[model samples]
Target: MSGVPMSGAPAQPDPYAAPDPYAQPDPYGAPMSAPGGQPMSPGVASAPPYGQPMAGAPGQPGYPQDPYAQQQQWAGPVIPPTQGGGSKAWIWGALAGVVVVALMVGVVLYVTGGDDETPVADSSATPSEEVDPSTEPSEEAPDTELVTDPATGLSFAPMPEPWRDSTANYGVIGFYEVTGQVLDVLTFEDGSGWIATFVVGEINPSQLGSSSMTTDDAINALADLVDGAHYSKPPDFTEPLDGLERNEVEVNPLTVGSYSGSAMSYHLSWDDDSIEETGESIALGVLDMGDGRTAGFFLSLPDSVPDEHLDQMLEALDSLTFV
Candidate 1:
């Protein structure tokens, strides 16, 4: 038991043994994680694995060699760096942004229309001073010498001088005297020895279908004055009579101060001998006042009448106006 006797001595772990294959390499003398864990510096490539060629070195991965000559051999070709890959992406992104902005501006303009004043279209005739039909009187009324009627809506001038003035139903039908032989029935004979008269009145509603009456209707309504049985007298009478002669009569359309009416004429025959013995005639004017009303002037005169008397009668007829 001399050399082999070893029983209760302390077991000592060896400080130096075979190196560990999986342990980390030394920092000062070895690569030490390739200097901050980077393979190489900027523009510098790492040395290829132990047996591989170095970058950009002859007979390395970057440089090619001629296989038939003594030149060094290269493993493969390398690609050269170019502009950044993000350049195209940046250009496309800028174009897309411009399109979006333009679309936004167009939408804003369309919504607002960019105008403050809206256009208006006027499709009416020219404007004029309006005259109220219910309030304004007719033009026949002068400043001081005018008379107005409210019932029929008419205006009348004062009767002319040297002529008698008469009215039926308180001026409903006005009568102005003219040159002629005075009769008991309020009628006169003109210089031609024919009867003359004038009257104006609102048309009877029974005779009118509407407010507007035609000139023919107005003339026909007064037919009794010229061709009725009461006015018809034979041509062979010595004594004077108050009747219209049944002779040929002519009727025509006429205009009087914006009024349309009828003008009529006929020969008088009061004598009992011949139709032409009387040498007198009648002239009549009947005007339509447009609102179922009328104004008429009749003249009975010799074949030849004084110009002065005729002019005066005409002036009176021309003075009529309607409201």
Candidate 2:
């Protein structure tokens, strides 16, 4: 009021403030908000306020190091499948089956291979084609002279013709006797306890035992061939026999094939050796064959003959024949 009766200076507005229409109310350059506003992702780490830096910021270099650099890991290789072992086993089994079948076929071929056209060697010896034994039915009695024995109620006969009397061939049927080195044939007259002996031939050895068995069977087949038979295996012999008195001798299971033998000997008398000065006068035998058939030589002589001449009996036996 003193200096001229009115005001001299006037007041001015702030320079950074917005004008009335674009004005913001917050003090820290933030837009004006409600009382409690929060950030969108509150857990994420925020930038440093003014001067501090982040721990592993990509743009920075030469800071702390990472510990897991040289560690190793593994992965396996792939394999292709082969043929099944079971299939291989089946193939082998099939081959074996074929081999077995082939063997069986071979056996069949062998079995059926025999010749059907081969002819028999001797037709006379065949049983079905042979002469009948029961009734010889011939007027000619061959060379044998049949005689009836009063003591045994038996028949004694001589060998048929052609053979005569063999004094030489002593292998099969001979007339020779052996005393050490010397061999002679036994001879006898019609007088005394002598009986006649019939003679025949040297048959095949295979047929020998069978012939013996067959003849034995036939002889024993008759009820009166012998009263009884006594089976004996004397220790002195290498074999055994079934002594059927005057009927026959049975040496079964004899091994004509084996190197060894079961040999035996025996004597038979009808209670009459009165004129005898030596041992018992009877029928003595050495051996035949086995195979159920054999060759036999027999003689009826006085008991006065010495034992040393037994080989002579065998030698005489070598002269045996069945007419």
Candidate 3:
């Protein structure tokens, strides 16, 4: 019981046992002996306790020496850590691929020269088709009834209804003392005795009974004729009629059709006579018909006549159109 070992306990060593030939040779050389006179295997060396250095390790006394320890440290290139994800070489490869694609796109744009863009049109350029002035529609004048003067061949629009050409019944020769040929006579049918007379004659001073050197003088002479005939009693009159009181005369420039002229307007009153106190309104116009010929118009209206009649007569004068 003293020498036999129990189960799970370490076996005791035999002093007379022989060494096995197949065992591995010791690495540190021959075997060593303990202080108690026991033989020890060379493969088994005494190791120091935990937290202490081994007795026979390097840098310690009696440590075994290595022949090639002093030649050099490793001195190789450093390798970066490949711990997290993909390596840095793969990232650099991807960046180079992107730069190459960008350069290729730039080259394509330069070669095509941006041909997809549209060109701007010039605003000041003329159109291809020209418009013909004759083909375009023109504004037409208003429609009106027109009458032509037999003497001057000039045309005009006569006054509206109830007014007629009373030339046959009216005495055109003795109407005015001017030495000219009478052209036309117009009057109202209402027997108001109002009349409009037109005349054409030479610009001779002796014939018009004035210093008619210019057309303006002729116009003034025509105005003077109306003033002499109606504004005062004539020296040749047989009946003793009251001379009409005259208002201030107004002279203004007038344009009728293509003729330019002057017009004289005034009002006359006969207070003592059988005629109404609000007597009459008179207007006279003289236009230079050119080529030494002048045309004259005289309109006389009693105050009893409607104002519309006067307006109609004036409109008739404006409607003159020279042939």
Estimated TM-score per prediction? 0.35, 0.21, 0.42
Clashing pairs in 3: none
Residue 60 error for model 3, in Å?
99
In candidate 3, position 160 carries an lDDT of: 62
Runs with alpha carbons beyond 4 Å of true place in candidate 2? 1-265, 272-296, 299-301, 314-323
lDDT of 1 by residue, 20-95 (tens): 3322322112211111122111011221110112223222211122122121111111111123421122222222
**Candidate 1 Cα misplacement greater than 4 A, ranges:** 1-159, 167-195, 205-214, 229-250, 273-280, 288-307
For model 3, the stretches where C-alpha displacement exceeds 4 angstroms are 1-145, 169-207, 230-243, 274-276
What is model 3's C-alpha RMSD?
70.5
lDDT sort, best first: 3, 1, 2
lDDT of 2 by residue, 41-114 (tens): 10011111000011121211111221221110000000111223111222222222322233234334434553
Top lDDT prediction, candidate number: 3
lDDT of 1 at 321: 45
- Determine which window of 10 residues in candidate 1 has minimal summed lDDT: 169-178
| lDDT tens digits by residue: candidate 3, 39-86 | 221111221110011122221111122232111100000111234533
The lDDT of model 3 is 0.34
